[model samples]
Target: MSTVVDYTTFAVGCLLALAGLISLLAGWAPTWLRHVERPRLFGAWALCLGTFCVTQLPALRTEVIKLGDPAIDACVVLLLISAAALLLGLRRPRRQ
Candidate 1:
């Protein structure tokens, strides 16, 4: 069950990251997402968050663990900061 959860998380995270990348570079996004005031910024946040989620998988965690606790903590902090920056940079959507 845990393995299943891990794979699901990884898969979801990958899809999210891919979508974010596409949105950020190509400006292709679903209609619902177009309503956002700053789609590109949101995309950047999604990419960072997805990356963080991917790193949370047990397999990746094990690799990071081999590097030491500080390494893992630093990576988490960096990703969080990056995601937060992108999110905070976004403004409220204009009134339609």
Candidate 2:
């Protein structure tokens, strides 16, 4: 059924969002807090979050008819802004 499909898609989106958040946090945390040294971690997080946003597209298009497109657009915009900020912060030169 459509309801079941919607729920499944939403669940997948939630998992992707959670994974992205965890990656972002791990990458942003101070060196003392994070154990891994993956240099592209933040970029990976951004990619994951972007994929999450893409997965939600169908539900935003068909299921949420009353709310219109603004909500989804807002979410995408916010994700983009957050990703940009993260990248900028990471790129800032370290002050000695």
Candidate 3:
């Protein structure tokens, strides 16, 4: 049952990864995504999220998430990366 759930999560993560790839390549987003000022960074964040999901699987989690250092788990790293990307993406460049 847990394996089945992991596979399902993996599928969703893959889809998110694909979307991130497209967004990164396009370097632009539809008007509906107006908030994504830096599409590439946003895409990077999405990719990180996808990876995080994949790392949650029990088999992978043992290798990816070191319980010894809870602060250094795969999910935590991904979250930090995504947060940085989001912050940088949202902030506008200052006018020279």
Candidate 4:
């Protein structure tokens, strides 16, 4: 039962992280997305997902699951990276 919940959370976290990456790539590939707004939006999503993963860290660590810890940590790192990229994008001028 508990194991199932933990696995579910881990799976959700992975999905969120993947979505964040896709959002980031989409933002990067479009001329319209070159503006600050898109990146900021994506970054916010990433940050939220990251925070969610971080919040689950304790439970994940305590669980019997072997891979949860590393997976959650990776999600956190990816979110932070995405957030940083968003911040940097916002600092630059939008393409005309």
* lDDT leader: 3
What TM-score does structure 1 among the candidates reach?
Answer: 0.73
lDDT of 1 at 24: 84
What is the lDDT, from 0 to 100, of the residue 63 in candidate 4? Answer: 59
Query: RMSDs, each prediction?
Result: 2.9, 7.3, 4.5, 7.2
Backbone clash pairs in model 3 (N, Cα, C under 3 Å; residues 3+ apart or in different chains), count: 0
Better candidate number, 2 or 3, judged by lDDT: 3
Displacement of residue 72 (Cα, Å) in model 4 is 12
Q: In model 4, which regions exceed 4 Å deviation?
A: 28-40, 47-51, 54-96
For candidate 3, the TM-score is 0.66
The clash count for each model shown is 0, 0, 0, 0
What is the lDDT of every predicted structure here?
0.74, 0.56, 0.76, 0.60
Error of 4 at 81 (Å): 12
Off by over 4 Å in 1: 82-86, 89-96
Model 3's lDDT to the true fold? 0.76
lDDT of 4 by residue, 1-96 (tens): 876776677677767666666666665333565455555466456645754664474565555255676765765675676566666656465499
* Cα misplacement distance, residue 17 of candidate 4 (Å): 0.2
Best by TM-score: 1
- Please give the range of 10 consecutive residues that has the lowest summed lDDT in model 4: 27-36
lDDT of 3 by residue, 57-82 (tens): 67777765455566346579887898
lDDT of 2 by residue, 39-62 (tens): 346535454565545556574656
